[model samples]
Target: MRSFYGVVACLLLLQALLGANARAETDTAAAPPAEVLTLHEAQRRAIEGYPSLKAVGERVLQAGARVRQARSAWLPQVEASWTGSHTDLSDVDVESARRGARSALAASGATAGLPSTSVTGSIIRLRNLAGGAAALGGIPESVDSYRVSLGASYLLFNGFGRKHTTAVAKYGDRETRAARDEATRLLLQAVAQSYHAVQLFRERIRIAEADIAFNARLLKEAKLRNEAGAASLSEVLNFEVRSRAAEAALNNARNDYANARTALSVLMNMEDGTLPENVEVETLGVETEEQMSLPDGEAALQTAMASRPDLMRSQWAVKRAGATVGQRRAALYPSVAAFASRDASQGGNSRFGEDDFSTTVGLNVSYDIFTGGRNRAQIAEAKHAQKEAEYQEDEAALGVVSDVRQAVEDLSTAQKQLVLQRDNARYVEKNRDLVAQEYAAGQTSLALLNQSQRDLVEAEGNLALARVSLLAAWHTLRTATGETVKDWPLD
Candidate 1:
């Protein structure tokens, strides 16, 4: 009886443990769902979070600061200064006293031997010596001197150097902004590709699962038929093998889906390097004829030329380089400036009286006399840079045309492929269904039914790929034409 009670207690403990586990699982499942991440939301996150994009944005700010710095040269400069010093004059006083005594003795001796005119001259010399001695004796042992001044200067002329510098800075700023926009456009394209890849792999997984289910159902029927001595053992084994293959395909599709999600997470700069389980990507919508229409190639090229950010940046670079050339050439001319200053200084005391103040004004001019051809070398370098920039601009224009044309052609091909794949998938699926029915009625061979199923699977995968390709091609065209950057809300 005691052993029975112990067994009952063990059963109750196990039941409680199971109930607790069930409750815990229920609590976990009751957690709120995370918000779904749409494609646009993912792009917004990338714009805000991507480190490279942020780095590019910082360059725009740096260029803006440079522009401000260049413009500051147009304004007058003002400055203020204060200076103080202390000096000891005791030794200087002693030397002056010794000189005075020698002068007095000489004056007295000359007066004794000379006539009336000579005596008057000696008296004048002696008086001057006494006054000098008095001034020297009155000198302080230490002296304090202080000065305060305010000055202003304005550039009268600089051979248009300031104008050219400002222009260069402004153009550089615009170029940096355009470069940033281009980076954003490219980032958006990368995000779109990954986003669509996830959807494509998910659809493939569904197709794989369906294939597995069909094979499993057939395998069960084959087993029953074998037991009834109608179907051979080889038939059952064939369905088993096909079922395993379908499972392997399903696993591969799942791995692809995960990889696509990981790629998207990287683009969005997710902290965990993967999206959360609850944050699901939206399913792709049905494609329509209107959505698959091709754009005119010539119009796309024109739009790209007018709107492409990289092309715009290249144009700005050329302008900036030209301005730099002008700025360097300005060194060949003289520079002129106007200046004004007011100063107050005092000695022997800290206070500066009104009488101690002084004022001055002037115009200054300067020209470089010689520089061992340095100025000319600088100008030459700037001219070379300008030429390089022009070449880059031409290269960029050609690249834009090529990119637009390629993108348009890709889009056209994708559109046609999608239509063809859609029809092929429909026919393949119908054939698979008829084959499956014939196999079930024992009117067709298992090999024919297997081939039909395989064909259907291939067709479906191709159709999904075509859809993703079309979407990617459309985005590519938008990026090439700079419409992606225009449509994005950078602010």
Candidate 2:
């Protein structure tokens, strides 16, 4: 059995080690490597590799891509298009088109030459060639048409809508990046909490093992007394019951350890259900009195508002919405577009190599003089959205302030608790030793010794909890400050 108090538990510290001789360390001139991961390193790996953070990273990339695609609109648009149609004219209103064409020709006073012999020859040649040899081969007057054109249109002007849209997209990109950082912070906080839980279980296992070893030796001593007729069978039975309970506790600790390992694996972005073998946990360190100090509530509130990422994102969202409003207002103005195109078609439809070519360049100006109240309604809607975004930004800022104040209070209380708990554990341990001595002298009952033992165990557990809470206190402060836990050791 191991000693208690200064080192209370005979823990299964090297519990998961592979086979090795106990003498392996002494024969080596070179020292064996210390492979234990410190708390800071564990927290680092958890935040840096976490899958939740990675998923958020993908979102950031996706939003950035939207910004890039929107910016692409500012570059010149280019396209090559080919269209071909062969129509069977059963559904065609040929008479209507002929009438429309004739009416159009008469209005233009161009049909005076339409019935002339030379005009007839020209019309027949144009129609026959365009309609294809099938038209001349008694194939009912169907039209075979092919058109190939390379065309492009750029918004020479759009009331500055593209500029605003580009601005909005840029803000959206920043919002996504901020969101990713926020996710990383939250994930790290969760990992730290769960990791501390695993450590608690580890300490429990250690305590249980120590109890088991102690009971085993105590049982032997009791047996020796029973053989000499100095102790009863009931005494052995009592020890056996405690031993069994200790075994159950150890099993529970092992189970908790396994689950905790799974949790850490997720935070480290390992494959699903990954658990490391032979991993070591560093012991919890003592906390300082000054670490418990708290500043004025108003300053803490301001710190949260100024540092929170969500608040920053809300501000960006408002800016983006305002930009959208500006973009909509810009849409109410005229847009200018300039275009130049060349066309040539031969051999029924090969517009590519044909010798014929024509080029035209001109400016087009388009403005909506009046549209059934659409533009006015759109501008109103954008303004309303901007107003809503402003409200959200304010709400987010207030929420950040409230959350930080709460975290500060929680951390301060936890720090004080850690100090008191440590002191309590030390006293309880001494009390348990005194009770054991009394039981040995037959001056105290077995029940009293047992109760003292339970008290000591409970005190140790509480101290471990307090240590874990101190770790969480730091995390809470960092989270409230919008400092990414991954970036923590700031400075």
**Predicted structure with the largest lDDT when compared to the true one:** 1
Clashing residue pairs, candidate 1?
A: none
Model 2 spans > 4 angstroms off: 1-34, 38-50, 81-152, 288-303, 347-355, 485-491
lDDT of each: 0.90, 0.74
For candidate 2, lDDT tens digit of each residue in 1-491?
33553253324434323224445555453555546755567778876676666678788888989899889869877777666777667635665555555554444344333465786676765554444433333434466677666767677988998898899899888888767666766776777777787788888888788778867776787789889997789878878887888899889988998888788767766666564564666776656556666656677677667767788788888888988898888869998887766655433454465456556667889999989999989999999999999999989987887788788888878878987998999999999889878866778887887788778878887887787777777777777877653365321
Checking candidate 2 for backbone clashes, the offending pairs are: none
Give candidate 1 regions above 4 Å deviation: 1-31, 85-144, 489-491
Separate clash counts for every candidate: 0, 0
**For residues 1-491, what per-residue lDDT tens digits would candidate 1 score against the true structure?**
99999999999999999999999999889976776788889988888999999999899999999999999999999999999999776887767766766676556556544564666676776676666566655645677899999999999898899999999999999999989988998899999999989989999999999999999999999999999999999999999999999999999999999999999999999999998887888877798776678878999888899999999999999999999999999999999999999999887676877788799899999999899999999999999999999999999999998999999989989999999999999999999999999988989998999999999999999998998888889889998999988877564
Q: Ten-residue segment with the worst summed lDDT in candidate 2?
A: 10-19
